[model samples]
Target: MADSDQSSTDSPVDSREDSIQDSKLDKFSEDEETLITMMFNLVGERWSLIAGRIPGRTAEEIKKYWTSKYSSSE
Candidate 1:
């Protein structure tokens, strides 16, 4: 039915939005921050490598956190 089709299409979009919201709401813990620093020192901006070491984190999220915390604004 059309209603079922519409609901199925909406499900993916809703889940994607929920995941985005969840990622935004989540903060890096102290241990995660320490791990990120250590990984950066070892790999030097290889975000995917660092992300592989951290559970439940993506490379993009790691890079954004690192840049926001460490990169100068000049």
Candidate 2:
């Protein structure tokens, strides 16, 4: 009886961990998609010239800001 109870408890804990992993994976994919779109919008635009204005700003930082700002609305 003790072994059976332990097995049942462990199963749910494992499943919950899997759920968290899946959620994180989904968020990462969504962030990548948003970043790609933002990059396309900036292509051949004047933004490229001003990119250096924000010293040390990287593509990842730009993507994260836009994702946090825009993705929530979507």
lDDT of 1 by residue, 1-74 (tens): 99999989998999999888557635898899999999999989999999999998889889888887788878
Error of 2 at 38 (Å): 12
**Which predicted model would earn the best TM-score?**
1
Candidate 2: where is the Cα deviation over 4 Å?
Answer: 26-74
Which pairs clash in model 1? none
lDDT of 2 by residue, 16-62 (tens): 99887545444545645554456547763333333443444445444
TM-score for every candidate vs. truth?
0.67, 0.33
User: What is the alpha-carbon lDDT of model 2 when measured against the actual structure?
Assistant: 0.54
Show the colliding residue pairs in model 2: none
Stretches of candidate 1 above 4 Å error?
A: 1-26
Instruction: For each candidate in the order shown, give its overall lDDT on alpha carbons.
Output: 0.87, 0.54
Q: Against the hidden true structure, what lDDT does model 1 obtain?
A: 0.87
| Candidate 1 local lDDT, residue 39 | 91
* Candidate 2, residue 55: lDDT: 46
